[model samples]
Target chain A: MAWFGRHGDGAEHRPRGRGREPQRVERVGLDDLTPDPIAVLGQAAYLQLGHFEALSRAASTAPTLEAKGSLSAAAGKVLAKHSAIIAELDSRGADSSAAMSVHTAAIDRYFEMVQGADWYEDLASIYFTSGLLDDFFGRITGNLDGGAKISASISSDAGSEDIVQLLADGMSKDPRLASRLAVWGRRLVGDTLLMARSALPHPVNPPAGEARIEPVLTELMADHTRRMDRLGLTA
Target chain B: MAWFGRHGDGAEHRPRGRGREPQRVERVGLDDLTPDPIAVLGQAAYLQLGHFEALSRAASTAPTLEAKGSLSAAAGKVLAKHSAIIAELDSRGADSSAAMSVHTAAIDRYFEMVQGADWYEDLASIYFTSGLLDDFFGRITGNLDGGAKISASISSDAGSEDIVQLLADGMSKDPRLASRLAVWGRRLVGDTLLMARSALPHPVNPPAGEARIEPVLTELMADHTRRMDRLGLTA
Candidate 1:
């Protein structure tokens, strides 16, 4: 289920720096190497929409007003980000609807595969699954420009930190829940990886002139591992 | 299940006019006559939160992206309004959490009673249920001043027109849906009235110095009938 193309032999190494500088690369323009901006943005919108749905569901199922409030706030942020992406797409004269349609089936299928049974599981899914996706977007969009950057930035900061904290707080109160959530986290990541590979566009030919997605995947996994450790889970 | 107090004998009639002018009345101040602003605003927030839940649910169930987008937009607006109401309560030194707790059971019960089965029903629920509530708020708050006015005004314009149009469009496409929705609309109003009467703070004693709530109920029902007419539903 690997979606990334392998780098060709003798690919140039680029210096790594921080603060939004496009990563240095060899053999292709970063724009050409990256996935189509429309597709990326469209997939982003679909994902945010999914987050909105999940948060709303969690809010309804939440046993307490405080939990419902927290979930509602998270959902609101997702909606705002989704709206910003749509506006960015509109400004670029891109057909957001068409782009969204392209990945809707895969995104919907992923959600169907990972429906949570309770509020805690829902929160776990958001904290782990969405956290990884946000980090992944941040990494992949590092080399993009213009509307792609704007759209990606809109989604890259999904405000899941609050949800993560909430989940952590919940687990802290009931340490036994941590073990169950650790298992849930594993399932979430497994389903996420499967979905990503199946849903995201894949490079057909050898990685020359195409963005090497392997490094991005590796970075995402490393971040996910750190997040799991923070949540008292084995990655 | 009636929550309103009776009007004092021989209370002078105030002339009705448009635009923010406080209505004229004899013997009682509007603020004294109205429900506590904090309570009203709190209930409004709860209702808006419910709308957010319903809209998000509808968006997920919607068959098309266009429908999902519309529902998302509506949810976003409700969130913004709820935030504004919360801020207003905060500025007034009212405890929003405490206020919200006062009506949580009633609001939850209302939702439990009027749960929508599908997207169209959800849309109708938003249109008829929320629309009537907004009108009732507007009528009751006509005499309120300052923060009370601002808070009520925030809730009074729930932006349900778009949802109403969505429902009307859906009904136009399938006329048979109208009869079903007409019945649904009746159930919505009945449940709403039952909830309102049960949840709202009632004046324990009869009419002396109490603002007349019967007139306001009559007015709300009349306006609701007009809205029903607009939707081509029999009141």
Candidate 2:
């Protein structure tokens, strides 16, 4: 079983961004290590943007008007969340474009690696993968240098109910979707968790940093399971 | 010169939709013929939806944050217009999805044929193609069976000011962009005008029908030139 962060992609060693990098380490809660604020904003902003791009494309191929409508609306919400984070970066007087772009290459690489084979798997990927990434964000929202305010703004953007309903509707029509999507959901976790891992403080000391990331990965998987269960998929 | 409508792909012979074919020459004005109301809503709705799809994808590859924002906002507007048309279809008690899906294959084929070679060309494609279409609809707005209200709705959706500004910004940055985009703009007209052609009646009688389409295509060409001029591109 491949563990959370490393999938033999050597992603841990990859430079997330040029010049602006994740913090070495920041102490927040007793055992909770908050990542660099810039890193958080960059990844959060670009991740939602990535999902917006994916969902919008998915809408074009969506077989039914109902599915198309659901996908478009969901794409809008994710885009709104992305804009909120960019707004946060702007408020801090940062070069919002630079901040967001720094993470673009990394995020793009992640999406390229995880494209779904079919429409159902695509939705499942966004559902489970975004669920884990959002859950991970919520975990690290500790005093992010007023970046927590953006997190608060983002909290209201929670729960892609439209997506969940669409998926559940799919299951009701075709019973076999359950097992097939369950497998797809499991396959998504490793890459998603790696994305979450990259958003954290750069592991200056790999062994210790890898150890510190354990609890966060476990919670992300747990949240991922709950999200899958809601869709009647066995996570 | 391959005149408007016949690039010889046998498109005039294509069955646009299975059951809801365009009305066979509805005599509206003295010289003008309005297509089927179902056909109008189908093509109009799907065309905007297609723009939203292209712009949304284009935004991902946009090189700058400003360009991304512009593309995304343009996408949102095009999406709004598409939804408004669907709402109009519903108000008439027509099956909106079926109406839209009818034109999906033809419209998809058009986009596939006219894809831009670069970013500027892509924006130009959306700008010039959508301009000519909206202008063509405006020309035929003579008592379109309550469809004119949607036309009025779409009229306000006119003039992608942001896209014009984006292309204009590009020209100011690079002196050579004007001519390069102009060449791309010319390449697009043949296919776009053909798409405009496909939206009309199936041309039961070709010679007379082609003769009837002349003045309208002339006006469409004039409007296409004006749209090209807006981007500083020669038609």
Candidate 3:
């Protein structure tokens, strides 16, 4: 609850920026951003690499062949995307190695915390955890000047339709999976938020007078809820 | 031993075909081949899929980041190559699923016998097992009419330079690794031949009058020895 408590004051001022007309606000390019966007994006890439590693582990241990193949294919795409992001960061002269090292422990701990007990749990974890991270990155990239390509690449590289179908088929085979995954989904959101609090910098944790963090968190939660609903799970 | 025993009579007649002209082969097209080249290719694809699965498991359990990344990348390429082979097999109306099942137990047992003790062992196993298979496939494809593309793909996809560098780097860091990997490499060739004898048809276990099996095995052993020499290991 540190995340919620930290943003309590900012939550009250969320409506202040909404009333301003879009044209009245100054456009902020990548250089004008308060915190370095490249660093943030680089960290995101590194975290994704960790997710790829975890997904690889899950895919290998998956009980069913269908799940195994689907997960493996997904891991390949994630690795490709991670490689692209690292290359792009290198081109921009960003210290991607530093970025990767800084967030490695936090993201790794997040994986340790949510490691699944069985195939169903593993599938649900991969689906929800990756889906939420993609949503978060998608939202953050929308506010940046030079991050559109990276954002699009990450979005495109997210799990394929085959993965979605695999999960659906799994649930259909065992109706009880619906309820189990519903609970698993909630746990995924909680752990994801905790990971964000630890792994990410501001605007995840804003300065005293800044209120941007609350709305971002709100939007992310809203998107997560919708995703859970689509999966026939309660958020 | 079973493999050697099966070809004992053939071993005695190995010198019979050495003086034949290179142009005497009569250049048979894909359609003229006995036992259906597509069936052979399909079975190879199925076996490669099994290797991909084993590589994934090894990667997940590997002890070092370098080993894990190298193995995972190799697994990805293997999976992609397997997919391409499956697609081609489908186009040729070959039953890839049946081909896959035919040699499943043999290939699976081979994997079971050589599963690694740690990251170093896994890397050596992957490097040597895959290297031998690629060599074997390359030789077999040379005799086939339409196997060039598949052969090239498998060879190109075998192991990247990154893997070789990874092994070399590991050995440089710990000089004793050369001796350990040398022993591991010999085990790999032995286990690979055992699997081949159990799974492959024909020349590997030729009839009494056909002595071609010895020369082929001899050539394979020579190639493997040269590879070991290249790696600074004894044959």
Candidate 4:
């Protein structure tokens, strides 16, 4: 593995370490690091500001009653697909791991929130709607499919029935139609981008200002660019 | 099982189903049924207002340094716990369901936003903290655990592993802790109650003044009371 060291100004460089493998070094303080903190903070702040604003706007302006209904239907379809996979996994008597647990925990949180007292108009309509876009984006951008693999790994049998597997099965019945879903997915992403742009320039950025997230923002931009190139889309 | 039904107004009762058996309704509409919209709306509005206000307060007055550390530690611990469970489940070869799949989709959305925006602000913190609450509520509420007892019908272990069996094995390592956990289940309920009071109210209420959750709230309260009494906590 290639290891880079931080120079005096925080720029990455080839640093000599003990033998072939480098002994890890820790920078004690922010000042001790070499990168410009202000620039880093600014980039981070802008990204968050943009994202939160986008989410707020997208959620707020969702198509209202029909939006919830349509989204719910899509959710149900998705669930059916996943349930089939889970049942198969159960039948196979396979093993699970930390990653599966993370997925489970993430899912558990979503369901609980949806069923909670606080689940409201905005979330049902906007948060979820825009969120669907983000989901598709991550999937397409990441260029992978694990739904089938996850399904095959677990038991969808009586012992381990999962909603995701159910949805996946349902979707597979008319898998070709799954491509039609791209229209809705595109709309969701568009809304999210709009919201992000609107929310980016607020007077006070949340969590921390831009400085806290510069590295992350930089990475995201790079990823976005890569994704765009892969998809033959203009960045 | 007991069934309750009413006309447009709260006072009128209509018996539409079978004479002895409780009727199973597929779904209930919130807006059309409520007699007093203002009260319901007020509750929703209150929740939204509180969440935003909390976000603001956290942004201005909360200790950023401590929050940063605690949030990271708490998230890590939560992730670790979930990972271990997933690992155990995977080892047994279980598949998740369609409902779980939908839930996972929602979770993936939140995760993307958090990671993409690298939000350290109040928004990210709120999402992270509240996610734990979701997990707690989901487990106790029977959403994930209560789907179906179809697993009991399985005659063979052709493609299945028993999660309970896995749990039992781990518990065998610390038999004393198992009993303690069973007993301490009451404390989890108590702690859940405390956290509910502190954090749940935010999501409960929203901006639109459309509080579409009185029945669920009442049911939750009643269930919690029953559990408390069963635990012999009643004075």
Candidate 5:
């Protein structure tokens, strides 16, 4: 759904005195200040989910005792920063049992596998990197324009033209692989939509007063379609 | 335990020209290069457990479509990488069921929390960062001379120095909060050690094979102790 390069502080060139929140630069939820609240909300939900994936993987597999300790400390800091999002979602009174159960089962299996004598380094690298990519993608997917803007910001030195070319080259080298990945990507979309539907069916309280979700949802869908078109993904 | 300043990478710079398998730049499992087979076994077991955690989280929580679609892809990658270690450990015919069950439960709990609104973002950041740190610590803990090397390296970089300062400052500014986080860190360590103890009572086999494990473990333990000393913690 989204794409962007990593955001290092010195890399962004957003002119001095822009007065934009610096934290927002590294971890921007959406790229633009679009007026469509629905699309913005959808995008927010999606990106939050993506970031969650990144955070969890990063914290759980710390290799050395020292590194693990440092990361645990980082985790505490990150949690403090993002507590608002959690509280907002919780205020919604969503039903998260099914998703939580499935997620937990998978982690258990991983713990079992790695704890065994069969673990290896190369596989560890692959698992770790690929997971990282997924999490980043989740963060930027809802609004392609915003994602592109952020991606450009992240790789301000090379910018989107270069990054997109890199992606294109990578994809071109393995067209079959890209196709396979696309199919998989579609499946994830489906799964996410299903989850969203599940969340919707529950009569959760709005973070603000009034359960005025449908209008917001409609606007979000429109923005998603707009983003898909921008990314040349919509047929 | 160790910190990497900008200068650290320069000192031990080994150009990857040809005919060198990275020269064991890291001291992994053993206390010394002289070798002590028993400790190697323990370290190897610990590494595998780390792998399992990475794989499970990547498979379940990775937001990317490709990563999520064929969970087997991640599984296959892990199996291939750890095949040797797996074989080595299996050869021992030890009972891993109890430990496996415990890990599975922990992972399950983690994933469940992730799926819920209560702790999604916090959990996500923790997971991904933890994976990166694991790789970093595993590789760097032993290549240096002593605690001075580690302190110099840790103090050299701005980011790491900031992190160290941030932790120290935070702990000092709010003792109650710092105590809570310290308690959390201790619990995580205890849980991990318990899992390792339960999973493999013996060596789990390193990628380098049985002959190489004891030395690696010895090195790892020494490095770990040094790092703990630097962090002002009891490991």
Candidate 6:
């Protein structure tokens, strides 16, 4: 009753973040050998849940009331998005929890490994990972039937808007923070990419799936680079 | 811009919890010599922020993803309400952070002392304190102009509906849980009352403030009783 229900056919998808204009949606020329719809929804929704969770933790430990206030709102927005994904699953007649529980272990593991040593690193972790994942999902969701509208409906800024501001503020205050966060920001991408790769179906014939995902991954990285550039950090 | 900017003149307020019709708002007619408007808003808003933080922690540690999903949504709602309060402060031309930061240490201290030993206890902690404080704030908010509209504007649940349901479900599954949580619920009230009392202004003649607050506290307790009754627990 709790975990086995698959209400939706699992094709649901949506984008998140500071609500940046999605990069060229039609330019990626990958084939339509898609993964299981439930896999996509479950993995995707759980990742959003993961971000919401991570952000919630960051908000709790945030040093300033202002940071707590803004970060909490951003975290709220992310969780609301996660709930919307679960609700979509429910509408499909899937047990929402069941749809997402499958990915709980992997998502939890990612959060555990990526927990930052301080607020700046934590914010950087949130910025880089959410930046990459949201862009990747924005593309995937864009391809889904109603995803474009859903993507458009969310706040124009990705949830990372505050992160970018806070990091910039911090880096400006202490030059060391900039260099250290740049390193941290770069370190985040490797795990983030691995997690993104996990969201896709495991390739039965490695090259076939690899060939399809390679271009998409490149776009995601490029998007990540752009976000880092906004903070004046190297990707 | 971030702190010390008072936007609203300190009259904004709202209620939260399971969408129960506010308990006898007309009947709890204690005198209107309330605490400073800014003080009330900051303390109330920061208290909600603290719950959001505490619940965020709970969701992170929740053993099951189902709990995480519901807790996270409830947390988001709380944070949104907190943000709305801040927005009201912003509208009044107040620095939301400066307004809230004054009570941050006090609110933070309460949260630190009241944290539960486990998820069940945590849920109960959320249930009891939010039940009590929301009722108190609801009373205060109801008395202010435009407050009822904003209170009503929020989701019918006090953001604790999920918490109530989850706790009820958990206790039924484990008799020991219900008993332990009942005890935990009682222990929570002492600290919660002290915190609530601290929210009001100090009087030159202490009995005057205490006199008005006594009846109000009584009503808050009755409301807590009603909420606890729902859980088949003693207040």
Specify the highest-DockQ model's number: 1
Q: What's the i-RMS for candidate 3 in angstroms?
A: 3.2
Instruction: Measure candidate 4: CA RMSD.
Output: 20.5
Q: Which ten residues in a row have the lowest lDDT in candidate 5 chain B?
A: B151-160
Return the TM-score for each candidate structure.
Answer: 0.84, 0.74, 0.81, 0.22, 0.28, 0.82
State the displacement of the C-alpha of residue B225, model 2, in Å, after optimal TM-score superposition: 0.6
Count clashing residue pairs per candidate.
0, 0, 0, 78, 54, 32
lDDT of 3 by residue, A1-235 (tens): 1222232334345346566433222221112223456766666776676667677776656655555556767887877777667766787787766656666667778887777777667767777777777666654554456767777776664564665677678899999888888888887888887665443454422452234344556666887888777777777
lDDT of 2 by residue, A1-235 (tens): 1122223223333355634222422221212445667768877877877787888978978888778876876777677777778777787777777877788788889998778888878888887777777666644543465545665655544337878887888889999988889888888899999998887775666665565567567767888889888887777
Ranking of predictions according to lDDT: 2, 6, 1, 3, 5, 4
Off by over 4 Å in 4: A1-224, B1-62, B97-235
Write the candidate numbers in order of decreasing DockQ. Answer: 1, 6, 2, 3, 5, 4
Interface RMSD (Å) of model 4?
13.5
RMSD of 3: 5.9
Give the winner by DockQ: 1 or 6. Answer: 1
Off by over 4 Å in 3: A1-35, A62-66, A197-200, A203-210, B1-35, B50-71, B95-98, B142-145, B157-159, B203-205, B208-210
Per-residue CA lDDT of model 5 for A33-133, tens digit only, reads 12232232333333333333333344355333323323323322222222323333344453222223333443334333322121112122122222332
Model 5 lDDT tens row, B39-81: 3222333343344344435445543333332331332232232
Query: For each of the candidates, what fraction of the native contacts does it recover?
Result: 0.84, 0.52, 0.20, 0.00, 0.12, 0.96
- The candidates score, on chain A by TM-score, as follows 0.79, 0.81, 0.79, 0.25, 0.31, 0.81
Q: What C-alpha lDDT, on a 0 to 100 scale, does residue B229 get in candidate 4?
A: 43
Q: What would you estimate as the lDDT of candidate 1?
A: 0.68
lDDT of 3: 0.63
- List residue ranges in candidate 1 displaced over 4 A: A1-25, A29-32, A148-159, A194-201, A207-211, B1-25, B29-32, B138-145, B152-159, B197-200, B207-211
Q: Candidate 4: lDDT over CA atoms?
A: 0.29
For candidate 3, give the DockQ: 0.34
- Model 4: how far residue B104 lies from native, Å: 9.9
Compute the interface RMSD for each candidate structure: 0.8, 1.7, 3.2, 13.5, 11.4, 1.1
Which run of 10 residues does model 2 chain A get worst, by summed lDDT?
A: A1-10
Model 2 segments beyond 4 Å from truth?
A: A1-38, A138-153, A156-162, A165-180, A202-216, B1-38, B138-149, B156-180, B197-215
lDDT, residue A28, candidate 2: 17
